[model samples]
Target: MNQWSGVNALCYYLAYILEIYLGFSQSIALILASVAFTQYAVFSWPPYFYIDRIGRRRTVIWSSVGCAACMAIIAGCLLNSSYTTSAVAVAFMFLFLDCFTMGILPVSWSYSAEVQPLRVRNKATAVGVFSHWMSNFVVVMVTPIGLNSIGGNYFWIWAIICASFVPLTYFFGVETSGRSLEQIDQMFFEHPRWLMGVEADCTKVVKQTAEDEEMRHKAYAKYDGFDQKEKHVEVVHHEEAK
Candidate 1:
């Protein structure tokens, strides 16, 4: 989570930092930042609609792969000293923004919200936000210093971070795309394995709940009749005694 969140948070700052390290003009930096932001805004939500259709886990996994690849390419561009490397790096930066916004940005929040029970969801979401911001804070603080110290090599660390997310997501990611919140809760209740990637059956759960309610209603009606009969028998017996 921090891997992508931190990268997304600190990436804009890189526009200015790169001006110094890569010796690019401020005009070019501003243009790159503008283009990246525009692409981010345009591509972010459209792909999100497909999250349910294609499944959340697959979207995130594939997007993470794209982000890692972009980071690697950006790092390689930085290592090269040709004039064309600047343009290529800018292109990869745009790719990074697209990939991050499309998958990591929305999934991080939605996935956290879906996995938690309704009773504690607000508090859990708060914690999730805090963790996310804390990661951003750390990255924001460390990035400029790291960029100065390591130059282009720092991006390889981010590439590795992005790559590591793929397996972690595949192993532990719960598919909540078509499942209800209660069904997700039950999934965790029944199988507490954090590493198990399972999709919930909300239809079956809802059907079973309705069946249980119907059975309870019938039992209550029968019990009510039995109580009334007992009361009538007691009344008759009391009058005979009198």
Candidate 2:
């Protein structure tokens, strides 16, 4: 999802695109790129507060829609050489970063971690990290070539890729918000279908039973010389519980 979103492609080549394709001077291109990143940094904070509230699947799906629209608009704008279109393209570039930072930037890594079982989580996370970098490398390597060879049409590829994520996530992705890892595991175990959205059961949060809570308290009290009143027992719950 992260790799094909064309984020790294834009991040690595924004200034180059501005200077070469948009006819901006070197200084102006650099300044605009810097401002775009500043905007990115500022927008990144909102997801920290809302990822749980809005849930991961919706965030990525909607963010992808925004990114695809921005890419399409930018591509269309670049097809013409007028000053107004150039300005629109630049504005959309910043909007693209806004969408990315709000959704994919924060959620991708955490979601990858959340989906893994505890025993193999480290290994799985390492593999995910490796794949992320490899994808980033591919995007960065081909971006210049695509921009130079295909010109503005290159972004159409990204627009299509971004647009595709919506259905892909909607069909295959599970709702991780407000679910404990154990609950998520149980969900997968119970529903073996590849299309998780069909049943929509995973979206429901399972409350911990009173019997289970009592058993946990009894187990904690069994320890010798420990102050049960002061002992902190960390209970993991789904995002909605917060």
Candidate 3:
């Protein structure tokens, strides 16, 4: 989960280096890239809406593969010296950014929000944001080195990086669709609980804990440490007297 999502978060950072490579119209291309990211972010929401439905594994796998192809295509476009190359490259690059941002980008945050205990949701969200930006900073600094390479060589490097992330997603990402939240718990946790021959709900861990505590008290039939039969007899006597 961390590996797939972490890489997806870094997609724009990698693309920033590749697409920002100076050329005939570099400044204009960059501004367009920024606009595309904001504008296209909406389309990517379908990925979010359906991620839990279609499942995280498929979404992550496809998004990583698509993002890789986009990078490779951008690199190929940049290699062309045609006057329209910059325009086409930026156009496609934004598409890839949009895909990543809306798709694999939010899955981990969703998981984090759902899985983290309520006491730490804010902290969990903060940590997620922090990790996101930290990676952003790293890629921002490192990407320039790729940019310094000869024309579009940065894209070639990013193409490789993008390609590498796909397999990482396939192997490490968990599927979260269709199954009850309990199944998702088994998929990631150290000790998965089985309830009456079925998996327990992962998302209901806190609720389950409360239920179990109440059940424990009922099972013993002991109010204030009274013996089980004594408690039962007392209840019966009270009912008869009524």
In terms of lDDT, the best-performing candidate is 2
Q: All models: lDDT?
A: 0.75, 0.86, 0.58
Ten residues in sequence with the least summed lDDT for candidate 2:
229-238
All candidates: CA RMSD in angstroms?
7.7, 9.0, 8.9
How many clashes show up per model?
0, 3, 1
- Cα lDDT over the full model 1: 0.75
TM-score order of candidates, top first: 2, 1, 3
- Model 3 C-alpha lDDT per residue in residues 82-198, reported as the tens digit of each score: 658766776676777765765666775675665445567789889987887776666666655655666565566656766676666554444445443444455556434332113
Which residue pairs collide in model 1, if any?
none
lDDT of 2 by residue, 105-201 (tens): 8889898988888889999999999999999999999998888898899999999999999998888888888666876788889997978866678
Top TM-score model: 2
- lDDT of model 1 at residue 37? 78
lDDT of 3 at 202: 24
| Model 3, C-alpha of 207: deviation from truth (Å) | 22
Total backbone collisions, model 2: 3
Please list the residue runs of candidate 3 whose C-alpha ends up more than 4 Å from where it truly belongs after superposition: 1-27, 112-129, 178-182, 188-242
- Candidate 2 regions exceeding 4 Å error are 204-242
Q: How close is candidate 1 to the true structure, as a TM-score?
A: 0.78
